[model samples]
Target: MTERATTSQPTPFATRQLHPAGSADVPWWRDAVIYQIYPRSWADADGDGIGDLPGITSRLEHLRDLGVDAVWLSPFYRSPQRDAGYDVSDHRDVDPLFGTLADADALIARAHELALRIIVDIVPNHSSSDHPWFQEALAAAPGSPERDRYMFRDGLGEDGSLPPTDWLANFGGGAWTRVTEPDGTPGQWYLHLFDPSQPDFNWDNSEVRADFETTLRFWLDRGVDGFRVDVAHGLVKDPTFPNFGKHPGGLMEVTHEAPYWDQDGVHEIYRSWRTLLDSYGVPERIMCAEAWVAPADRLARYVREDEYHQAFNFDFLETPWQAQPLRAVIERSLASNDSVGAPATWVLSNHDVLRHASRFGLPVGAPRPNGIGADDPQPDAELGLRRARAATTLMLALPGGAYVYQGEELGLPEHTSLPAEARQDPTFARTGGLELGRDGCRVPIPWTKGGASLGFNDTGAAWLPQPTSYADLAVDEQTGVEGSTLELYRALLTIRRERRLGLAALAEVEGLGDDVLGYLATGPDGRQTLVVANLSSTPIALPEGAQVLVASGELVDGQVPADTCVWAQVD
Candidate 1:
């Protein structure tokens, strides 16, 4: 499509609905390496201080060279940017801040030329309140066809003055916002799950279902290999719209049962999407869920054979850096996905919460907090980097697909000390400084050693300021340094592919201390790779005669150092 080529053939394992490629008979995504690009912070091409499509195109080679198989780009669709680009106004057009539709075409072409797959972000859970449908809904009478496309109901109090339910906004307000009719009188309240600027779509509406299906085809025809479905689990809510007794919480830390997410109807929508993806005939498209639901088994439902291809493993990402919890999450994820014949996707830092580097450095077993302000206790940077590197090495050797967020390879931590006035995340503004927004991790990345924007922009202008400390961790500075974090990532990726570790079978090796994790990755060709991660402060003895292929840190007398991981060729 659009002259960008793709490979697709009927795989012998038809039950999998996956196409095989490369020298190995395995599906490309089974153990693929996917890089996530938070568009606004990645690079700025037009000098307006915002990263765009051309900026991302200019950096495609960096991904190719780093050995990643694909790029899962964050939403660059036309939007109000209220929740960044997640509040999409148009599914078919590109945001001017990111570039035009033509630029998107060129990006697909360039990525295909480099043999890299392209995955675009699709936000079906909600649309920008400014979207045509929502705008129409605002003008139409309550209970009309326009209003039916979304959830609109009468307020609970006298004369419909209050919100429809007791549900609280995930961002700290009423989840329902009342609309004003043309007559200047108060109208029915509408559902927003997120910010007031982003209205949740009623998935039960046939028009809504048809519109999303059309949106999928439009992108597939443009040659996108797949889509990263934003808030995938939140698409279909309970028909009754029952509110929990307490104020409704966020998708992240819902330790209790909730009706707002991971509903059964959501699976039917994906099944339809899957059928539509297969309609293309040959080149099969893939979809990954950003579903943060309860229970390992509930999350697995999103990736059944008839639904999406991959689901991000938030369980693993949210687990503490300690060994046992991490090991348990991994085991549970593998078992859950294996039951459905789908690959479990792994991710660490994204355009979301604090970067794992800083997160690991924090006190172990602490609650997952969002913002670490200037007044917050600073993280141990050295310890964080050590753990981050070791964790990356271990993740690369895992037997499934993995996602790498930008600037993470260079050991970039969250810009925790950003001033309040500089904050851009809606969560911060809506919560009145009580909750730290995602802006810290979304800060502009450093690309070069010297420049006002650290080579991210020619004008040294960025929408979000880059922390001065980023100058030392710039990509140009880390490009060739042997022990640099960038090199560690490149080497780990190179070794992973060369050894086919992604397609290998994993067997947990016991007898390691409670604080240490070890696993054996065995290839079908008889090649054995042992991966050991030392999460404790004490060093652990390494296997004798297992030649070290690569390591996160230096070993002392055949002992794996604390917070270090090693990939060894077993004897």
Candidate 2:
């Protein structure tokens, strides 16, 4: 394992003498600022129009300088490219489209050398339809061991033509797809909660469990610090094959009593994985769940002491931008995670969701569409960026680990006007364009202001076309520019690190007003930091004698402007 190092460079905020750190007492992830890199869009070194392992390695300095403690990489494993690499064809190999296994090793080594831990995505819930095991299952007879590895069952109708249950796929269409036997006769159907190209695994099968263990150790031995579990809540489904009753085109209406998601059996799998992680010894391996589970209490189960280390707080992400609703979700998230002795993880924008900047730009209570098209109503770009910065400031000041999506530091907004023909997400094809899908948010990151791909590759090639406006948001353009979103993030992260805000911190939610969200966080050293956001249309007064540390926007007359967030050191 690589040793951690302190940088000699000056921080944007006044650096403080923080309390001595204790690695054993508090794991690095507890208060970590982990950045998410959608590998396909991060950078393209070989210039094949797709981002790859070597490409990510070349850009490590960007993240290191951005003040992130670690990076959570999306999958680059061997795949058929169905569902954008979420469908794994070979769990142990890197896709040629990405790079060789050697490249992955080099990326991990280089990341560790920079004192940045690497957390890879582990999709245990399903494998690609083209996976070797799935191919074997296709040739095997019904009830065969190969078929037993997945959820294959007889259909409901007399002709065995209908799906076994009335479950709907999260992407679109029925959850089950009937397959033709090797003899050319229609056979049992297989269950897939997502796209049909991705088949769900039978977790009750010991072989499935054993294979995942091998996959985990493969990456662990390769020096990966941890994993971000995909579909973390949907692995173990009920054996009875119960119907969901209704078909929703989006995320399933899963509840604690739901047959598939958030099942009690899922915890058993996580507990076992936790044991495997512990077996790795010092500089502990961790797992973060991307589970979209229910109420705060239910979501907390995934992070119980013996289970996963962290679970994404989707409830917090789904909450509206209003002060009261945001505070309510924050309070519940903290209380629930605290119950399980785990730190709540906060996130604003990720690959799958609409970018928070654009989301906030919409009128309050407007529909949160998955994708934006040229004909769709446009978001107020200036308003969206302002609110996004403020929202991030508030998120970083809270008492836990925080996630920053790849281009979030640059205040990148979703490519709302992405043409339909340029979209590739399965949801778009499955829904026949009713839903624009996630392609808008997955555009390649712009590094330099001028190029065909805006400096994403030396050859100026990109898989997804970047917006013309990206020139203004390019990293080089904003790197040291005062009042730029990138600089503001640097300042906030610097303050957060110096104060050790994520470690041994206690937060007391202050009832400022219906339009203001305020909290006071006390670090272990007894230093108090007050975070306040004026989400209303009117400015709000800051606490008297509060030493301003960072503000998302300028303060007017000693008061925080509307749609602004401020972090101040208080007595």
Pick the lDDT winner: 2
RMSD to the true structure for each prediction, in A, is 6.6, 5.7
TM-score of 2: 0.95
Global lDDT scores for all candidate models = 0.85, 0.87
Residues 1-571, candidate 2, lDDT per residue (tens digit)? 1122122332222222212222325878999999999999999999988999999999999988889999999999999998889999998999999999999999999999999999999999999999999999999999999999999999987899888999888887889999999999999999998899999999999999999999999999999999999989889898887888655333422556667888889999999999999999889899999988878899999999999999998888888889778867887888788778888899999999988988889888776897989898988999999999999999998878999999999999999887778899999998899888999899999999988898899897788889888889999999999999999999999989888778634444344678988766656565677788899899888766788999999999989999999998876
In the predicted model 1, the residue pairs found to clash are: none
TM-score of each: 0.94, 0.95
Per-residue lDDT, model 2, residue 48, is 86
Tens digit per residue, CA lDDT, model 1, 1-571: 0121121321111111111122357668778899999999899999999899999999999999999999999999999898889999999999999999999999999999999999999999889999999999998998899999998899987798977677777777788999899788988999988899988999989999999999999999999999999988887777777767555544455622567777788999999999998788655688988888768888888889889889898888988888989988877888788788777788888887789989988988888787889898888889888998999898888878999998899899998888898888888988899988888898888989888899998998999888888999999999989999999999999999888887766667666778988877765565777789999888888766778999999898789999999999875
Query: Model 2 misses residue 234 by how many Å?
Result: 0.2
Model 1 TM-score (2 dp): 0.94
